[model samples]
Target: MNPKISDSIPQEDKDFDKQHIWHPYSSMSKPLPCYHVKSASGVRLYLDSGQSLIDGMSSWWCAIHGYNHQELNDALVKQVNLMSHVMFGGITHDPAIQLCRHLVELTNPKLECVFLCDSGSVSVEVALKQAIQYWDSKRQPEKKKFLSIKRGYHGDTFGAMFVSDPENSMHSIYTSYGPDNIFAEAPQIGFDDEWNEADIEDFKRKIEKHHKIIAAVILEPILQGAGGMRMYNPQYLKRVRELCDKYDVLLVLDEIATGFGRTGKLFAQEHANICPDIMCVGKAITGGYLTLAAVISTRSVANVISGGRTGCFMHGPTFMGNPAACAVSVKNLEILRTGAWKSQVDTIEKILLKKFKPLMESGHRKIRQIRVLGAVGVIEMKNPIDVALYQRRFVELGVWVRPFGKLLYIMPPYIISEDDLNHLVYSLISVATDESLA
Candidate 1:
């Protein structure tokens, strides 16, 4: 938005957007202030206000390869000229075929079959449908209700919301709208805390007592993203897999947020060294270039669903396997294959840990606790923040860190430099320790 440049965009256009357009989780009548982003490249967003900001949220944690990535851009560009989109019902393309193979290679080998969809929520829907159909094929149609952990978030879709924490989540209002599902207590053991065997007891008991009725036991492995960005021990996931095996319950992992090297490992489930019966992947699938997600399942589950009463999976989105999205996704996996995210995440974690270390001793009453998992760093506040107040502050400080609920966190792009990261953390610390706001 440099007014001097011919390509610069005006900030006045946002007024029209604010009046007509509805943003995420906001009412159009009195929408939260919207920032006009004219363009973005790498880890920085160029605004219509002629100010540049270092992106900390990574556009809701999707653009892991950062914005306008060359390889992904080239892949998408090459695909659109051939064909932008086509019905994925019967027709297929090379992009979808290639992306699925790479997805299988990155994820669990047992999760060999991929069901491509438009977004993360749809992928969860596909997983739920797979579980239900698998049970029906086995003549256990009664086992339809899902069992999930408390404070866990899968997606915003009805099926996904039902299995998420019913009472605590923002989606709680829609609890009665979706299917009634079972929920175990949220794991109490912190990510780096001492192993608490008792933490598994409630989950173990829930599965034991309701195994007959539970269609699947679903949870976000190791790190639960939307559920307050909490991280738990990998042992909990390991034990969950064991119990699922013992009780004949399928484990569905929502790796939409934790997949693609976000949690130090390629997938958060890998921390437990276990494979899920059905796994959902999205977010970084195409390096945030386009909308895409996939539900990968075991060969047996795929066979059961295929050989079921309907003779086909019930759900089929029109844009299920978009060629352009798939093409970009193939290149995205190729980028991740370089194994650069490991060192990147390690460096981010170290920077967050070191920078936030002084804040712990600063004893800011507003900050409840500080936690870091891989590339994510969170400041759990004693109370929820005023979104407009903190957002304006972040923009003024030359960074973009969206503060929601009682959590102020940053999940930056993996390619961020040390100086950019330091500034990002500094911005958070400033917001957290700002005595006037406190």
Candidate 2:
């Protein structure tokens, strides 16, 4: 057992949380019941109620190695004994250097430069700035707009929001407050569907028409999260890369959700065998241990931005390269490099396909579609679901599965055992088959 940080918060503290704390787009006035977790280990969450539930969300798809991992804990402890955080403005540390080197080696060769940020959104914001500054350096300041697909999700920050699928994105209400970036229709073909020329043509025309004003073409690549758990063909990615090169527009792939073997590759862009000018990665970077994201770019983009009108990147978070986070991230990459994560994800995909087959063949009218990729399994419903209701039901069934809009999905920790995974499947089936849930 780990040493205690402090005495545990009593029930009164939770009541106060209900009264005051805002929980991620939830209504405080009619707040949903917040489950108080006491501790977590492996793939299970131990609640204050003394009950443990299998974690199916992976803490929103970040905790790849699961909770309370000894290796990650040791890494953090060692880094804490040395130092935690230091300013990255003019100073650097071994943790930061080693982490950056690991990231560069993991990605495409041209993507050699890394800009560490505090979160996924900030990394994307940095990517946007890099693309814009790259164009500004090339003497085309008006090439400032970003073009993205209709169902893509980058992040919630203003710049990231501008490049996301505004209409379907949760930040849609703030559309009037942010820049109106262009949106091309999402590819019609599924990941497993036949390659369609029409899909490429639709996106090609949009890029060709707006190439002059578009500084970059940003996409989630392969899998789209948040907006929808949508998957598309890698061929589209290849074509998009070609179009970007043809128009001299930079390509920015936001792999915050798809990176780090989540989509059966260390980077989802690898599926297409093409490289982006800038790539944003986060989530599993630290094995869900700490907050750390990065914006990796090619040497050309870095050089152009350095010599640009701005004369610098013009952005740096105070905790840009937190040593503790970098140290944990390096350890996380080391764990992944063992090649076990690939086999684990492949096993997850196969199991999800087998377990979800009944639902796929159920012929239920309420079911819209079902899809699985890598470790992600999604059940899209025809009608919008009551998030609070479904979440409560999942918890009652001894699992944690957060349903958003019409999508009920699970991206469990890669270390999950078959028995635990089957239990998660049982909970999902219970939610889907229950007429009362509708």
Cα lDDT of model 2 by residue, 1-438, tens digit: 221211355767867898989998789899876787889999999887676789999999899999999999999999999999989988999999999999999999999999999999999999998888898899999999998899888888888888888887787888999888888899873998889878977778888998999999999989999988999999989999999999989999999999999988888998899999999999999999999999999999999999987789989999999999999999999999999999999999999999989778875777888889999999888999999788888877889999988998999999999999999988887787788877
lDDT of each: 0.89, 0.90
- Model 1 residue runs over 4 Å out of place are 1-12
Worst 10 residues of 2 by lDDT: 1-10
lDDT of 2: 0.90
Could you give the C-alpha RMSD of every candidate to the true structure, in order shown? 2.4, 3.3
Count steric clashes of candidate 1: 0
TM-score per prediction, in order, is: 0.96, 0.97
In model 2, which regions exceed 4 Å deviation?
Answer: 1-11
Candidate 2 pairs with clashing backbones:
none
